[model samples]
Target: MKVLIITYYWPPSGGSGVQRWLKFVKYLQDFGVEPVVYTVENPKYPILDASLEKEIPKNITILKEPIWEPNNILSFFKKENTQQSAGFLNPNPTFFGKILQYIRANYFIPDARKFWIQPSVKYLKKYLSEHKIDAVITSGPPHSLHLIGLELKKALNIKWISDFRDPWTEIDYFEQLPLTKKSIRLHQQLEQEVVEKSDAVLVVGQTMKENFSKFSKNIHVITNGFDNDIDSTSITLDKKFTITHVGLMNADRNPISLWKAISDICNENADFTADYEIQFVGKIASEVRHSLEEYQIKKVLDVGYVSHQEVTKYQQKAQVLLLAVNNVKSAKGVITGKIFEYLQAKRPILAIGPTNGDLAEILKETNAGTIVNFNDVENLKKEILQLYSSFKNGNLESKSNNIEHYHRRNLTEKLAHIIKETVS
Candidate 1:
């Protein structure tokens, strides 16, 4: 079977955005599916990891087209929002920034990438006439890409699949955006059209499946999986009890209560103060920085952002990995992509979110980590102290069970089955 995947993020554009499709494309050929990638030619990515280019399947066909980015042109008006990555808007912007934000919210409609939709449809329309593809998969957040899929389906009556790595209207920031009632209604309408028209709709979590089930009868929950593992032969674990968070973090995910608990730990236990260190491995919002300071947490090793190659090492070596989900209306469905990799890392995961949310369910199924609710500062402190004691005893590690199904190869096999079903 052959599938054409239309996505904005690809190799050389790093971070969690590219990892999903990149890993899928890597192993799709092994599952008897030929994957053709269509992406932007000149992408102005906020983060770049040239290392990811090596992961692309050799001899695979990759289609690229030039894109005119409105974000770049709008940068002069709203430097902060323009520079921000998708789904992560600046928590606080200047007065003028608010104006641009309003413009972005109302004018962009689906997203700033809306401009790419028509051109992509025009480009892919020509390509489809020439090449033989059994199905077309549109991966989004630049949800406007789904509009391109909608157009292709109408134009050619092709089998279409829309993959939502994250939710559309249910995304945490959507309600927080400066969108007017008309804009909100428009967003919802488009989301419904895309979900209803697609032959299959893919989401990353169960909550998302439940939320979107009313729209699409063929919704499938295919959570992100980890393909790579790090070698821990030479790298020694840090002597200090380290808690590390990897990937892009926004204000919504800032763990204020967790920081307070850590602060209390540092204050109450003198030995803990000397032995504790917190590290952030990617772009952290200013809100997170202020919270860290408010707690008087001094020991920090923030390596801003690094490549995927380096991230795996951090995941493998940290004494405990911290996963913080957004505390918003959509928090229940929000599952950070890194959790799968953290499971593969075999380090104890300390997560903060709804105790019964999808993330907690995964941790329970795997027995890889413990989760404390957002306001449970007492339990948060206890969990930290328990981890600290384990670190002292030198036996703190994750013993996950039944995780092989979440491997990239296995996930690709499942995806191939879906593709076959769609085409049939």
Candidate 2:
């Protein structure tokens, strides 16, 4: 069997967006599926890691076409105001920035990547005619990629699967978009169309699957996972009681309660103050920085944008791994990809968000970590103290169980089964 994957993020372009499909492609051949990747030739990627190129399987076909994104033109007007990546919602906007946000929310329709839909559909229509692809899959954030698959399904009548790495209309930042009522309805309409028309809809978490179940019966929950190949044994643990978060810490993801709790703990406990160090390992929003400063937390190490290989090392070294879900209306559904990687690191995890949410469920099931509510400063402080006490006693470790199910290769096997069923 052969599958054609339509994705915006690919190797040489790094971060959580690229990892899911990249790992799927890496392991699919073992399950008797030949993967053909279709991606942008030149993308305005917010983060880049040439190291990820090493993960691409040898002798696989990678198709690329040039994408004309409006962000390229709009970015020139407000270079300082423009976000380096998508999904980082600015809680406060300048007057000019608000104008750009208004245009992006209302005029851009689905996204700035909407411009690539027509051109991609036109290019792929001819290519599909000659190709022996048995099934089509489109992954999105730039949900515009799904429009291409939707069009191809109509034109070529191929078996198409629409994969939601993140929710579209229900995304955390949707409310912050400055969207008009009509624009909001349009987004919902497009989201419904993509879900209902596709042969299958794959989502990263159970909450997403439940949310989209009204639109499509063929929804599947395929969570992002960790590669088993990474060598975790060689990494040396940090001497300090390092609490590290390893991905983009946007304004929404900034755990204010946790910071406040830690600040209070540092002031009250002399031993913790002497040993504890907070480390942020990727692109941090300005708001996150301001919050840290407000707490008067001094021992901060901002090691921005390390390669995937380096990230694994950081994860292994940390005394406690931190996972912060976006404190938004959609917080219950927001399961960031780093959670599984944290599980694989075998370090105790300290997470802050909806305590009754999907992430908390996983942490509870695996016995990998402790979770506190977004505003639960008392419990947050208690959890931190407990982890710190365990660190002092040399008992700081994650007892993650039944975690083989979350290995990258195992997850790919499950994905291949879906592709086979869809094609058949």
Candidate 3:
């Protein structure tokens, strides 16, 4: 089967989002499928982790089109280099940037990718005329990818699959988007259309599937998993009570209360003061920093974002992995993309966020981590001290059974199955 994937995030970019589709494409051929990817040429927001680009399968067809992000144009006038591995325009927009956002919010039919729609629709239509494809799958957060799939399905009669890496309206962080009434309404209408028209819809978790099932009957849950290729050898340490958290750190997911407990414990206990490292890898939110300060935990270390290849090094170094969920009811359904990688690292994880979420369930099932609630600062502090003591006393270890279900190959095979059913 020949499958065309319309996704905004892809390799040369490395973060949790890109890994899903990138790894899916990697294993599609083994399941008797050929994948032709249509992705943005220069994505507006990108964290360039080139280590992941090496995973893109060879001999696969890649269709690239220039995405007209207005923010990029203003950056050009400002003498900014938009092509850096860290993709996209900076968040602190210039005067032109605000105007561009306004136009995108109001003038664009549904999404910011409205500009790319005309070019994508035109280019893809011509390409489809000459080539044969069994299916069309669009994965999105930009959701513009779904628009591309929707158009192609209408014009070419190709079976379409709309994959949501995150929920649309029900997304936990949707409230953070400062969208106008018109933009919100437009977004809802487009979302409804995608849910109704697609032959199949794919989501990351059971909770997301349930949330989406209210909109459409054709929904499936295919959770994210870790890439087996990440080498877990670089930071193999013998004695260090290191706790590590990777990926984006938004204000919501920052466990401020837990930090307070940690700081208090560190201040009171001479043992914790003598041997403990709170190593935060990747981006850190101001809220987390403030909490760390409030707790007087002066030992906070920010090892700025590193390449994907280097992530395993840090993971291997960690005695306990940290998984955080924002303090939201919607977060219960969110099974972060980082958890799988943490699993592959084969370290004892410490989940400190939501108590009832999918992350907790996974940890309980795998016995991979010690789970703690967001508000339970006392218990969180106890767990921290226990883990620290275990590391200090050489007693910390992973007791979880193997979780074969989360292997990337299995997840990709499931993706292939969805494509087969959609095309059939």
Candidate 4:
């Protein structure tokens, strides 16, 4: 079976968005499905990791078309050499920034990539007429890609699947966008159309599935998972009781309570403080840095934005992996792609988020780690001390269960099954 995947994020454009489809495409052939990737020829990626290019499967078709984004025009107003940061949704914007956000929200409709929809539909219509594709899949956050899929389906009557890595209107930063009442209604209208029109709707978590269920009964929860390709048997653990977080730490995800708990523990127990280190492996927001300074927690290391190849090494080495969901209204629904990787790392995880959310359920099921509520500093301190004591006794480890279900190849098989069912 041949499926054409339309996505905005792809290899060499690193971060969470690229991993799901990239890994899916990597293993699809094993399940008797061939993937043809269609992405922008030149993209204004917020973050770049050249190492990810090595993971693209060989002998697969990759089609690219030039995209012109409004960010290019907006860049003139900002400082030179200032790249756009992901997950940094500025809650409070300057006057000029607010104006830009207003224009982006209202004029751009779904997103800055809205311009790509018509062109992509037109281009893919021609390509599909000549090619022998069995079905089509479109992944989005730039939910505009779904618009392309909708048009293609309308034009060609193709079997189409709309994949939502994150919710459209329910995204964490949606409220922060300076949107008018009309724009808000338009976003909802478009979201409803995409959800109801697609042959299948794929979501990353149960919360997303629930959010879209009202629109489509053919919703599937194919959570982002880890590839079991890393050989961590020979890797050595870190000397210190290191708590490492491996992705972007925006202001919303800043673990203030955890920082206070760590500080409290350090103040009460000098020996524990001496053996503790808090390490962050990606971009850190200024607010997070300020919190660390406020806590007087000096044993810190920031290895800014390492390649995905390097992430597994850090995950394997750490005494405890830190997973902090963004403390927003949608905290209960946020399940990051890193959690499954942490499970595969086989290290005890220390997560800070809602205790009853999707992430908490996964942790409980896998026996991966303990989760404390965002405000539960006392519990956080106790958990940290217990882990520290275990570290000292050389008994700290994760007894993750049912993790085989989340392997990349296995997930691809499930995805292939869905595609087969959809096309049949």
Candidate number with greatest lDDT: 4
User: How much does each candidate deviate from the true structure in C-alpha RMSD?
Assistant: 1.3, 1.2, 3.3, 1.1
lDDT by residue (101-190, candidate 3, tens digit) is 456456655555668877998999898879998888899877777888898888878899999998776676555444689778878888
- Superior candidate under lDDT, 1 versus 3: 1
Task: Give the C-alpha miss distance for residue 390 in model 4, angstroms.
Answer: 0.5
Taking all chains together, the TM-score of candidate 2 against the true structure is 0.98
Per-residue alpha-carbon lDDT of model 1 for 179-271, expressed as tens digits? 999999999999999999999999999999998888878998899999865576877887889999998778889999899999998889999
Q: Estimate each model's TM-score.
A: 0.98, 0.98, 0.90, 0.98
Question: Which lDDT tens digits does candidate 2 get at residues 72-114?
Answer: 8888887674665556856677898789888988999799999
Judge candidate 2 at residue 237 and give its lDDT: 85
Off by over 4 Å in 2: 80-82
Q: What lDDT is obtained when candidate 3 is compared to the true structure?
A: 0.78
Candidate 3, residue 391: lDDT:
83
Summed over model 2, clashes come to 0
The list of candidate 3 runs beyond 4 A from truth reads: 73-110, 229-235
For candidate 2, the per-residue lDDT at 128 reads 90
TM-score of 4: 0.98
Against the unseen true structure, what C-alpha lDDT does each candidate score?
A: 0.90, 0.91, 0.78, 0.92
Instruction: In model 4, state the lDDT of residue 381.
Output: 94
Model 4 per-residue lDDT tens digits across residues 53-143? 8889998999999998998999899779654453685656788877877887789989999999989998999999999999999999889
lDDT of residue 352 for candidate 4 = 97
